[model samples]
Target: MSLQAPPRLLQLAGQSLLRDEAVAIPAVKELPRELFPQLFMEAFTKRQRKVLTAMVQAWPFICLPLGSLMLTPELETLRAVLDGLDVLLAQKVRPSGWKLQVLDLREVDENFWSVWSGAPVSSSLAMSQRQTGEDCPCTGRQGCLKVVVDFCFGFPDIVLQEFLMHVCEWAQQRKELVHLCCKQLVLSVRYVNEVRKFLEMMDLNCIQDIEVHTYREMDSLEQFLPYLIQMKNVRKIMFRHFPGCIYCSPRIGAEIMWELISTFRKLDKLQKLHLDMVNFFKNHLQQLVRFLKNPLVSFTITGCWISESQMDRLFLSPSIHQLKELDLTGTILSDFNPEPFQILLEEVAATLEVLILEDCWITDSQLNVILPALSRCHQIISFNFCGNQISKSVLENLLRHTVRLERLNSVIFPVPLECYGDNFDHIYWERFVQLRAWLMEILRETQALRKPEVILLCTLPCLTCGSRASYDLEPSPCSCGKLGREP
Candidate 1:
């Protein structure tokens, strides 16, 4: 059979029969290793206690996703899953380069953590290597295999505890290599104490990347700052604030924002930093400016409230001049002065290759003030300024300024206000047609230098779906001639 066809096909065929429990129970051993992952999923969903236990013992590789089992209120299925996993850990013979790796502990909540952390391990759980060197299964050198665990909070207490203890036991066996190999840790801020406990249990110094997502309002970040600061070698950091149950409540204070930035300053090897839905105060802008002094390759700040005065210092900073990709989408600056933004554009004209400022409320006056500097952004390859109040003539002039930008390749503009809003019976079709002509003209003019990807979306939000949807306007006689919002 191996000679005639590939093992993957045979594996898929055998697992197809496993859907019928009676047939699978009899032919389980005949299933190939390639079908192991699929069988685990089926057993988990079907609650086939025996099959789940059997597959765990037969699993070829070491990485196990304990969380995928979806710990139910009943512990019977959970016990079967864990017991089968123990057998693999205690196996007498193993593959040459094999060692336990990558245990996923996601959706772990407070209740789950409480039960497992202090639970006693069975003496029978000890593996052959710990008992004697006679039938030692692991031949891989110490520190050869790295273990990465994906942890997310909000699991019930008992389940989370069991998951943590499992990780702790595994780490104990490979004490020397475990920390060196562990790479990334992600935390969601629903329960701060739970996050702290998990961090305390793990070796933070060895981790390379940390991502923290916030859903609730945290009054102070004192508990997380210290452990994060200790991870000096961490290279990438991401902080995103998600709207919580209080839909209208603010996310964080200015002081907290500065403190977060200050925490980032402690890491010398930081390369990429992403902050979303964060508010910035004028006083806190200095901390952000200082953090940018490092030669960062990518900087993204979205849904932030930055005044025109603050934008002035941020854009002219020496750090902005070195960035390769700069994204400032959803940062409201149109309500303030435009001179500062124009100056900042001039400073980054030579270095920035990608610029995104969607939904920033940029108007004709603002575009006019920056047209001279915008033309100098010759290196920009991708540009997006959609969801702003730009008129047809102003946009045409804007294109004329950027026509000579040989490197420019992608552009997405907002529909001019003249053609936006609710207009039935193709009232603005002529204006829309004129806009399309201008776009085609630009393409024809720049055909030799750069063929840019240009997209212009309808300015009005869809009355039905609440999303922007462009209309297919025909030349008055076609079916699309009647294109308009449905009543």
Candidate 2:
């Protein structure tokens, strides 16, 4: 029988792998015999003992079964113990300065969710059952596979928080990567640097997943990126940042990070790239746009827009024709003239399988031009158009054209409101009703798409009002003040 190392697990906790000294492990190794008798137990041989010793010493924490539980007569039991230990070491210990990697979750839940849920699920509705109380019908007898309810509100809670650094060693033996979550990362900037160095270490090769999320800037990232650029197995990378991420200011931001990201070209095996801000994206707009236009298995852009030059380069890239998933939200397409964007759809609309346009400046004419071309993207399964101008005629026609579109996301128009010049409170309810009727009339020709498959998310009496003119297309949060409907 052939033996294979375990797969990489996602690093979530939001703690930098290098900066968290408590977790930044030097290479795996054995402690002096005088220190731990737990490994000297007769059940563990020289190899098994070597692996066990490394786990606890590698990191400050880990999650595992009780200490003496594996003192058994079974070889299978011993193997399970050793493999888990090996994975633990792999995640924490690394060589000097060569391999930093990151991975994701789809690899972990392979068929595990089936065992957990006890039934096969295909539809979105079927998979979205997080409610509790009743025994899961999928598991006729077992109920839910795993259920632990505790109000531990923070980190090390969702993941292993105890001092069992031993768990890392156990994972190393099996040749698997450990897992971490992003939300668990709640720390100051000073410590995030530690994660960078730990990841930069060499021995920590063959990784599966690691995510480092920061609110403002990833200043420490520049140092270790060159090492990560060498990982032969890095397939997916997801970066989440908050607000403008001012680190990305005009020419300087992109000019600096461009060199760092250039290392990404080393991962000839990469399939996914998820970026979270519009600012940093602006720097590498042209190259980033071209990179996205390729055979990427999945692409998602939330609240980001393309630059003028990048939009021009997009037309030249043949990769734009092979994308599988695409998502864009709160994008400012109007900043530049909408012509290049229009030219873009004319070429790639037929190849797009998934499209999301929310809070964008989409005119009815643009939608009309793209409709026939889009009908050919037969694989389209998800379409989210929340708050954009869709001509009543095109919208009605879209419903019919979306045959393979499994999830046809309907629209949420800006709520109707009347502007009361001086006294904002005196704004009457009748004014809104009248405006609502008028807006509906604007799309009256295509109001027939309110059926079951199309999810129509509606919100009215919203404090956020609409534009006085027909041009402004910006997002406004719900401003529901203390004023209630007039009695």
Candidate 3:
């Protein structure tokens, strides 16, 4: 074992100063700029409220990432930091070397701390410049201090909820001097009124990502869209568990769908869109695609049925031509024609990095239609077709095609039909082992530039234990299968 090194002279001196707040508070202004971060980190960690407040008042840096040091939310620590700002604001003459403009309360700036702890100072300066780039709302605004925080409404954490509420109230009280910048906002429809009021209080233009989770009536979304439309800088939007408008009249449902699709036109910077269990967009996909003004990098639609025409319209949309990630997990397509989807694959082959079609129920013939296009996706990194039924011959053909994808690293395919009995309950483990071995041999024979790390053959979940059996280089059976029980 190696002996640990003792603390540096500067660290020991700072600790001694912190032991007496009366001396430390007065010494903060006279202390060297380089010692602030290290000393502040120690003071924050020890919850020395007065020292932290004094350090914040004399902070020399342009951005202080206090949130990074907060491993867990502490109301006293947060209140201490805010109270320092309150003191700083009331001062008639700002302290010399007072460059603090952004107090970021987001969980970031780990690099800032590392660089301050002995790394070159220029590297820390460069990171600070990057963090406070031109996009920063308070970048050159005189006497305006921007406080950045990520608000997650309707979360179950009581302490965090209280902390956020206090921050909101403080920001509201000093609106003229402070700009509350929220880049990411998550809203649960259960607290619709609270979220609405929160959005109204903050600057919406600073928001870049927004997610809405709804388990109630569709009107919750209808009520929330006005606020969403104002977030012009939002790059990603996700709607999860958005209920269908079955309780309303058909005409009223159509109106709500129209309102929802029309709101996308205002989000010119949107690059990623995800809709899960949102059934209202079944026939309105074409209208939605028409409103998207920019190309999308990621698109995900799960557990939503689409008709043949809607599928064709989706593939034909120009916005999806540059997609890097596409996930259609649980979107049934066994009966739909595959020609339109084939065109989409061909269109996005150059840029597509991830493709997931798990539980889509695609047939062998449909897979054949897209195999040529799939083979050309040279940039593909991950591919999943789990829960689809295919014969051994077709699976072999699929593997042969995938061997050409040099960048592919993961491949998850369903076990071939030959390894199963009349139903998925009766899995032929011996046959599965044989087929997996054969497939491995075939992969070895192909000799691609890069082989996938995960080449798994998955089966349906065991009826008894609800565990799935997967065959890779070795077979892993579920508990029921290992016990020779009927599952």
Candidate 4:
């Protein structure tokens, strides 16, 4: 009953151009400036090597976001682009229309391509105007073209590794003409020496985000600290599987901690910090918090345990008072006194947007203690308290309190104990359905305007599949749960 529409005139022309690379290659110089992006996208996606290379050499835009088109690392395409750059560099006098300065190898600028490809003529013109108005930092500097990239050092892809090696060598050959800027760097401990060598060759000041994953490496963190201290412009740092002093002496451990804290002092621009499975900092957290020079916008400490005193010190720290995102997921706080956490909530309530306390084993009494401070967070957009134990009445009270916070959009809560059977592995289906209906009713009655997505999570995983079951304001069960319901 439906018919397929014919291809647009532009699409047919692009296809015809792609059918013959020789003609397309020569026509790039005389082609309309607006057609470059759309045609380049088509050539790049279809792997028209010669045409793609020609377009790169004669590109009219200041930035060529090649990385956006590269969904997977393709060695041949990269080589062709580099070859075009080689031709561009070899020119004694660049073409009048040639404006390429930044070859951004980051997955960005999708809208630029989309607008030029099929958007309205007005949108395409507007995009071209905006691109013309934007200025590059390396604009006027002689022979100072920038090549921006994000590197993940430990990925197990040989083609990607080879592609990066070629790029590195190319940049090294033209160091004066090319500025290789790495914005986000993820380093695995196994490749510390290689990463160090790479970092030494590039400008460290260009790095904005860095993540270090030490997979139980005893001395990797210490070895990397010297290099980390030099990244003064880094805005965020994350440490995962950060080890303790099980393999080294206490004095050596203290020395490493001191070195780390010193590195923190050098990163004055740091605004976000995450430490996951990092038990080594439990004893020195207060000192670390004291050394932070700037107020953090996000601080996440997951899968690590710290004492009540350490938490109290953290709550009192001025560096975290204005936090917008706070995550304490999997950090046991069942034994912690509620006063410190309540105070922390109140301190950050005005700015807090995302608060995740999943798997903290919080009890009904603890929930009650912090509910008042939690309700005052007017900017809270997402709140996750799954894996805590609370009663139906307490959860109802919690929902009622959150109703006044209009910015709340998502809330994940633990299924009340009243919905479970003698043990958590078995669920009372009838009770769960009734309790969920009641909670929905409460939200409908209390919420004046916006209604947040409320999900009830059962901590126990399904016996058939290892996935935990969650109810989204409805009794719809997971696939495994549906089998259990068969009569």
Which digits, one per residue and each the tens of the lDDT, describe model 2 over residues 332-443? 5544455555555555555555677666666666666666666666556567555564444455555455543434443333222232223333334465445445544544
Cα RMSD, each candidate: 10.3, 15.7, 3.8, 3.5
What lDDT does each candidate get? 0.60, 0.41, 0.82, 0.78
For model 1, residues 1-487, the per-residue Cα lDDT tens digits are 3566444554456458666877776565566655555566656667888777766555554555454345533456656755665665565565453434434333332222222222344442322122111111232544333344455444356865565556656556655544423346666655667656566666665566677666655653545777778877677777676445444225467666777778778788777666676552334554564674376656777877766666777766665566667787777767767777677678778787988877788889888998898888889888887767788888878767776787877777666777654552233656777777877787688677655655444443444444554532322122332333332
TM-scores, one per candidate:
0.68, 0.52, 0.88, 0.91
By TM-score, how accurate is candidate 3?
A: 0.88
Better of 2 and 3 by TM-score: 3
Please write out the lDDT profile of model 3 over residues 151-263, one tens digit for every residue: 88866788988888888889999988888888999887757875566777888889898888766455766888888888888999887763443331222277777887888
User: Candidate 2 lDDT (Cα, whole model)?
Assistant: 0.41
lDDT of 4 by residue, 1-487 (tens): 9997887677677888888888899998888886788788789879889998899888988778888788877889988998899898887787686798778787855666777666544455543443321233344567677888888776567877777777777888898788788878888765687666676776777787999876555477788887788888898998776243233222237788898888898799999999887677778877887788899999999988788899888888888989999999988889989888899899999999999998898888999999999999999999988778789899888878877788988888777888666656667778776877787788778756677765455544455675566767444454667312412
Best by TM-score: 4
Candidate 1 Cα misplacement greater than 4 A, ranges: 1-9, 16-85, 88-145, 154-190, 206-217, 245-261, 280-282, 335-353, 372-381, 400-409, 421-427, 460-466, 471-487
Once superposed on the true structure, which residue ranges of model 2 sit more than 4 Å away at CA?
Answer: 1-166, 169-192, 200-205, 208-218, 242-255, 289-294, 335-339, 346-351, 390-452, 457-487
How do the candidates rank by lDDT, highest first? 3, 4, 1, 2
Best by the lDDT measure: 3
Model 2 vs truth, CA RMSD:
15.7
If ranked by TM-score, best first, what sequence of candidates would result? 4, 3, 1, 2
Candidate 1 has a TM-score of 0.68
